[model samples]
Target: MKIIDAHHHTWDLSVFPYSWMNNPHPTGDISHLKNNYLIDDLLEDAKNLELIKSVHIQCQGGINSPVEETEWLQSLSDKQGFPHALVVYSDFLREGIEKEIEEHCQFKNTRGMRYLLNYINNDPINCFAPKEALLDTTFKKNYSLLEKYNLSFDMHLWWTQYSYAFDLIKSHPNILNIINHAGTPRKRDEEYLSNWRNGLKTLAQAPNTVIKISGLGMFDQQWTTDSIKPLVLDCIEIFGINRCFFSTNFPVDKKYSSYEKVWNSYFDITKDFSIDEKEKLFFKNAEKYYRI
Candidate 1:
C-alpha cells in the first residue's frame, strides 16, 4: 500500500507571509489552517504507514517574494528528508516571473509552479484571480516558459474554469498539467454537478492533464467515506486509472478528518480495484508525473 501524496502543503506562518491563512474563508471556518504545519506534524497525522513520498504544493507566500517559499521548503527537505519535491508559487501577473522561476529552480527539489486560477461570479471574495486570468497574454507567456525549465503546472481552478484550463493546456502539450482538488468542486447541486461532469470529461480529453482526487473536505466538511466515494470514483472513471491519483491535501483538509482517516477512506472506497489499479492511484502515477 505504498503512497505518494500528489498534492499537499507544509507551511510555517512565522517564517513566511502565508498571507491567505488569515483571510476570511469561503467554506466557513478555516481556523484549523491558520497554524504552522511542519514535517513531523504531517508524518504523525498520516500514521506513517505507507506515505513513502510527498509533493508540497505552494501555500501562498509573500506576494512579492514567492520564491522564498521554495527556498524554505528546500531547506526543510534538506533537514527532514521528505516532501520529495516542491511546487512553489509564481505570480504571472507581476513582472520578473522568469526570475522567480529561475530562483525556484536553483533549489534541488523544485518540480513545478502553482498559480491558482479559481474565480466565480458569485464567490467573488474567494476568487484567487479575476475573470480570464488564465487567458491573459502575460500569464500564458510566463506559463509557457515552464517548458524550458522542464517543470509541470499544478493548476488550481474551479469547475467553471475547466474550459479555460483546457484552452491553456491544449497549447502546452509538452508540460504536464496536474489538476488540483478534483477541479475544485464548490457546489454539489444537480445543476452544478451536471455542468461539473461535462467540464471534467472535456478536460480529460487533454492527455497532458491529470486529476488529483483531493480537497473533498472543502465542500463536504462533514464527509464520510460514503459521501466522497462517488467523487473519487467519478474522477477515476472519467480520467481512467492511469491518469488519476489520490492526495490527502493535509492540514488544510485536516479541517475534515485525521490523515489516518483520510487515507483509510481512500483505501476503503477503492477496495474493489485490482492491485495494479490501486498501486497507480496510490503511488505510481504520482511518482511518474511528479518525477519523485
Candidate 2:
C-alpha cells in the first residue's frame, strides 16, 4: 500500500544547531542521533516499503529563529523531493510571530508548525518552555497566528495537559491541530492508559483535532508489535477511521524497529479491515489533511 509518513525528521548537524540532540533525551541518551540524517539516509532507512511522501516535523529546540529550519528544509526540498510538506517550529510566547510566520509560509511546501509543550510539572527545573506554556496568556494570543496564516499545528503534549489543551483548541477551531505521538502514553500502567484514552476522547470531541500514532517504541525498553497494537488501535477507535493516521517517526524510532517492521506491525494489527479502510489509515487521510 502507498504510505504518507505523517511525522518524521531529517537533520544536518553541520547546517544548524540542535541543542536537544546534544544533551540527554528525557527517555534516555539520544546523542547517537546527533549525526546527520539527510534525505539519502531516510531513503536508505525505508528501502523495501512503498514509502511515497512524508511530512518533515520540526526536530529541535529553537536555539535560533524557528524559520531557519523552514528555510533549510525548503532548500532541501528544492533539491530532494521527499518531504512534500513541513511542520516548522515556533515559540508562541515570542513577539514578531506575525513577521516570522509570514516568512515561513513563503515556502511552497510549508504545511504547519509544531511547538513542544511537553513539560514536567513536578520537575519544573527541567522544563524547557515553562510549565504553563499552553496556558500562558501571551502564548494563547500568539497561537492565533496559525489561524491567521491558515496553517496547521502539530501539538505534542502529555495527556495530563489535555484539559488546558482543550481550552486552547476551542479558542482556535480554524487552526488544524494534529496531536502527535498518540497522546504520548509513555507509561503502560492502567491508570496512565485510562487518562490517555480519556484525554484523547476529549480532544476528539473537537472536530479540528486529529492524532498521529507514532513514537510508541519509547513506551517499553524492549518493545514488540503486540505491546503497541492496543495503543495504535485505541487511537483509531477514538478518532474513528478518518481522523487518525499512522507514521513511522523514522530514525528516532529506529531504536525499536526497522521501517519494514514498523509498517508490517501496523498491517498485522489491522489485517481484517477493508482495503479502503486500510488506505485511509495508511495514506489517504494524511494526504488530504496535509494537502499532499
Candidate 3:
C-alpha cells in the first residue's frame, strides 16, 4: 500500500545539537540513537516499504533553538523533496511565543508545534516539563497563539495527564490537536492499561483531535505483535479509521524494532479491516490532516 509516514525525524549531529541524544539522563538512555540520521538514512531504513512522504516531528534540537531544526529541514526539503510537514518545537512558558511563532511560520511547511508536556509527579526521570505545565496559565496563553498561525498542536503528555489534556482540547475546539504515542500507556498493569484505554476514548470524543499511533517501544521496550495489537486496534476502534494514522517514531523506536517490523506489526494487527479503512490508516488520513 502507499504510505505517508505521519511522524518521524531526521538529525545530523554535526550540524545540529540534540542534547537528549548526547547526554540522556540515566532514565532516558537513548544513547543507541546518538548517531546522525539524515534523510538518506531514513530512506535506506524504509527501503522495503512504500514511503512516499513523511512529517518530521521535532527531534530534541536543544531548548534554545527549536526552530533551527525546522530551518534545517526546510533546507533539506528545498533540495530533496520529502518531509512534507514540519512539526517544530517551542516552549510555551517562555517569553515571546508570538515572535517565535512568526519566526517558525516564515517557513511555509511549518504545520505544527510540539512542546513536550510529558510530566509526571515524583517522576523527574521521565518528565519533560514541570508538573503543572498543563495547568499553568502561561501555557494556555502561549498555546493560544497557534490559532493565529494556523498551526496544529502536538500533545505528548503521559496518559495520566489525559484528562487535563482533554480539558485543554475542549477549551480550544478549533485547534487541531494530535495526540502522540497512543496516549503513552507507560505500564502494562491491568489498571494502567484500563485507564489508558478510557483516556483515549475520552480524547477521541473531541472531533478536532486525532491520534497518531507511534512509539509503543517507549512504553513496552520489548514489544511484540501480540503485545501491541490490542493497543493498536483499540486506538483505531476509538478514533475510527478516519481519525487515526500510523507513524514510526523511528531511530528512537529503532531501539526496540526496525522500521519494517513496526509497520508490519501494524498491518498484522489490522489485517481484517477493509482495504479503504487500511488506506486511511496508512496514508489518506495523514494526507488530509497535514495537508500533504
Worst 10 residues of 3 by lDDT: 19-28
Between candidates 2 and 3, name the one with more favorable lDDT.
3
What are the lDDT figures for the candidates, one per model? 0.87, 0.85, 0.86
User: Ranking by lDDT, best first?
Assistant: 1, 3, 2
Pairs with steric clashes in candidate 2: none
Mark the regions of model 1 whose C-alpha exceeds 4 Å error after superposition: 62-64
The estimated TM-scores of all candidates read: 0.96, 0.96, 0.96
Q: For residues 22-89, what per-residue lDDT tens digits would candidate 1 score against the true structure? A: 67766877887778899988888777578899999988765458777787888889998889999988
Model 2 Cα lDDT, one tens digit per residue, 182-264: 98887899998999999999999999999898888866747788998889889999999999899978778887788788889
lDDT of 3 at 97: 73
Tens digits of per-residue lDDT, candidate 3, 1-292, equal 8888888988888886687665434235778777888888888888999999999999857446777778889999888887889999888888777887899999988899998898878877767786668898889999988888899998988788889988988999889999988877788889988989998999998999999999888878889999998899889889988999999998788989999999999888888889999999999999988888
Candidate 1 vs. true structure, TM-score: 0.96
